[model samples]
Target: MPQESSHRVVLMVDENSNPFEMSCAIEVFGLPRPELGRDLYDFRLCAAEPRTRMRDGFFTLSDVADLGAAEEADTLIVPNRPDTDAPRAPHVLDAVRRAHARGARLVGFCSGAFTLAEAGLLHGRPAACHWMWADSFRARFPGVRLDQDVLFVDDGDILTASGSASALDLSLHVVRRDHGAEIANHVSRRLVFAAHRDGGQRQFVERPVPHIRDESLAPVLTWAQERLGEPLTVADLAARARVSQATLHRRFRAQLGTTPLAWLTGERVNLARRFIERGEKRLDVVAARSGLGTAANLRARLRQETGLSPSAYRRRFGPSGGEPVTP
Candidate 1:
C-alpha cells in the first residue's frame, strides 16, 4: 500500500455543465471508501465564476468556492462544459495554468478539453475529446493533436477523455496510476465498471446496420463481441450481415468513420488491454485470447495503435508485479 496524501481534488463546474459528467468525477473522487485502505481524495465542486445554474434544472446557489480552491488542489478536474465553441473564462484558464505550474494534475472530460485548449495548456499536446466535436476542436486549437478515436489520452500530467462515459475510465486510470491495479480494480468492481479502458479505442464502434435509417446495431455487435477470441475477418462479418463486402465496408465507414479492418483490429486490441490490465503477463495468452493469432502480431498492432509494446503496455496498465518496462 502507498502512503496517504493530504492533497485535495478540486472539480471546476460551470453553468449548464452536464450533471452526469460532473457526477462521474464526484463518484470516482468525492465518495469515501475506507474498505480499500486507500486515502479518499477530498473533492470540492467550485463554480468558475459565481451563481451557476446546472442543466438539470437546478441552481448552484451555494457551496461555491473561489479560484483559491484550485490553487490548493492536488488534482483539478474539468467536466464537460456547456459551450465548447466559446472562449474559456480567463479566470478559469489562469487557475488551471497555475495549478499545473504548481505540479497539480489537470484532467478534462469530453468537451472539457476545450477549456484546457483555450488555456493553451494543450498546445502541442496530444489530447482526446468527444469524437462528435473533433472537427470543431481542431478548428479552434490548431496546435493541439486532437485524437478523436481514442477513449482517452494521458499525456503525463494532463489527461483527457474522448466521450462522456470515458470520464469514468480516465478517473480509474488516475487511481491506478496513483495507487495500483489492485486498488483501481477494487474501485471498478464497486462501481460495476471495467477497471481500465484502452485509450486507443475508436469512439464510435463499427457494426452492421439493417439499413441506412437503422440506428440499432446492438444485436450484431453483441454477436461479434462474443466471438472476439475466434478468427473473425471482414468477409466473415459481411457474410454474417448477409451483405456484400463492398456494402459492409461502405456502411462501416459511413457509420463508424473507419474501415472494417481497422475496427476489428481495435476490438482485438481492446480485448488485449483488458487481459493485460487483469495481470495477464504472458504475451502469448493475451494474443490468443484477443485473436491476434500470434504474439508478434499483437506486439506490432499494439505498438502501432498505442506507441507501446506489449510488455510496456502491460507494465503501465497491468497489476502490481515487476518494474514498468522502458519504452
Candidate 2:
C-alpha cells in the first residue's frame, strides 16, 4: 500500500498491453516510501473492460477501475500495447482526450506512443516510441516529430520513452521533476538503480558480435574522464586510443551513437552540474574544473541541456545539509 498523496497517477490498460511497462509504472509510482516517511503519488490502474487480456493473452488482469477513473489522474499513463497496428478502443481514446483536456500530464512507455498518437494528442508534438516501430509510426502519423534515437522524449505535458527499459529512466525523471534531485536519488537508491540517465541517451542499437575483434572504447573513455580539465580534443582522444581521428569517429558512432566531442562535452556538463550541486560557489572555478573553459560556455551548456541556470539549479537541487544526493 502507498501513503496518501495529492498527486494521482492512473494507468490505463487495454487489450494486448505490455505487462513490463505496466510494472514499470507501478514500481515507480505505486510503491510506498517508508524510508522517506511518506508516499510519492496515489496510483491506480484502470481498464476499459473489467478484465483485460494483456500482451498475447499471457495473463488476464482483472478487478481494476474503469476508464472513467482516468479523468481524475494528475498523471495518466497510456498502455504500451505491443500490437501497434491494432485500433485503439474508442472509449480509451476518449478517456485520454478528456484527460488531456483537463490538463493532465500524459506518459507513454514503448509502444504506448501509439495510443497517444491514436488519440490525436501527438500530432505536431515531439514523441518517442520503440525504434523498431519508427518507420511504421512515421508512415501512420507523419505529423509527429518522432525521435527514435533517444531513450525518451520530454515534450513538456507529454512524455514518451522509446523502449521497455527506458520506461524506468523516464519514471525516475518524472520523480526528479516533481520532487528534486536529492529525493529522486533516494528513490533510485532504494531501487538500486542509476540516479540519472539523460533522456537524450541513445536507445536504438543492435550491437552484433563482430566477425573480427575490435578495440573497446572503455580504456580511452576512462583516460579522457581523468583529464577532462586538460583541454582534450578529438585529436587527443584518437591518439590515446592509438587510432586515427576518422577511425575513432567511426568507433564512437558504432559503439555510442554519438561523436566523441559530444560525449566529452556531455561528460563535462555532468561534472559541472555535480560540482554545483556539491556547493561550488565560484562560477569560474566550476567552469575551469569541469573543462567548460569559461563561465559563458558553462552557462550555455547547462542551459541547453538542463534548461536551468547554475544558480537556479543549485537552489533547487543543492544540498541544504539535508540528504546528500550521493550515497
lDDT of each: 0.78, 0.88
lDDT of each residue in 218-308, candidate 1, tens digit only: 4555678789899999888888877788987777665655677887777787678667877788889989999898999989988876678
Q: What's the TM-score of every candidate structure?
A: 0.69, 0.84
**Candidate 1: residue 106 lDDT (0-100):** 94
* RMSD to truth, every model: 5.7, 3.2
**Candidate 1 Cα misplacement greater than 4 A, ranges:** 1-9, 27-42, 48-51, 55-57, 72-74, 83-89, 124-156, 159-215, 321-327
Candidate 1 steric clashes: 0
Worst 10 residues of 2 by lDDT: 205-214
Q: What is the lDDT of residue 39 in candidate 1?
A: 59
| Candidate 2 residue-pair clash tally | 0
Which TM-score value belongs to model 1? 0.69
Report how far residue 319 has shifted in candidate 2, in Å.
Answer: 3.1
Residue 212, candidate 2: Cα error in Å is: 3.0
How many Å off is the CA of 154 in candidate 2? 1.8
